[model samples]
Target: MGRFIALMILVIPAVIAGYGIKLMRDTIFTLLNTPYPNLSVQFIAGFILFLAGLGFIGGFIFHRDKKNGKIAPRFKRRK
Candidate 1:
């Protein structure tokens, strides 16, 4: 099924990215000599990156109510 394959393709990367970020955060912070004490920064960075990846993947797989030609509005106008 085309839909199923597309859905899988989109989701699998997100899942892997999430897990990979977690692993990286733990490994990086678990060391003794490091500027970052806790993993808050790493966690947040990973979170943002993961969300970005999801957005990119979802742009195609997720459907939006489209009539003719329309575009989604940006959250904030660029200066």
Candidate 2:
């Protein structure tokens, strides 16, 4: 059950990241999404979404690693 929950958390962010990529790609090809008024807005929103999702995933992994003592000495929490 714990593993499933963890997987679910990871999957949601991955889907967000994928959608962000799609948005950026569509904007580049001049296929504007109706929700966004212009290419620039679409691209910017995509960029934010991509970074946010990626950051959340990265942070999750980093926290797990730190908890498992797999992080480098420089990154380990000060005792």
Candidate 3:
């Protein structure tokens, strides 16, 4: 049961990560086609999304245990 839960947790985010990658790919392509000087705000937003997507996907792969198959997110310290 624990293994099953772990697998499910991993799979759900894996699917979401796949979607994020696709969405970023398409958005980047679109942005490239647009005129220069896309709003700084726009660039910032895109960069944040791109970074976050990569982090989640990368962390997921790195944290996965092939035996039990769980994806664990890094712990955050709140001040």
Better of 1 and 3 by TM-score: 3
Indicate the TM-score of model 1: 0.40
Instruction: Give the per-residue lDDT digits (tens) of candidate 3, residues 1-79.
Output: 9989868866776665565455556566665324324544445555565566667766766655533545344433246
Model 1 per-residue lDDT tens digits across residues 1-79? 9989878877887886776476456757763225445566556556676777777666654343233235455532358
Count clashing residue pairs in model 1: 0
Q: CA lDDT, every prediction? A: 0.61, 0.93, 0.57
Give the TM-score of each candidate: 0.40, 0.96, 0.40
What is the C-alpha lDDT profile of model 2 across 1-79, one tens digit per residue? 9999999999999899989999999988999988999999999999999998999999999999988899899996688
RMSD score of candidate 1 (Å): 7.0
In the predicted model 1, the residue pairs found to clash are none
TM-score of 3: 0.40
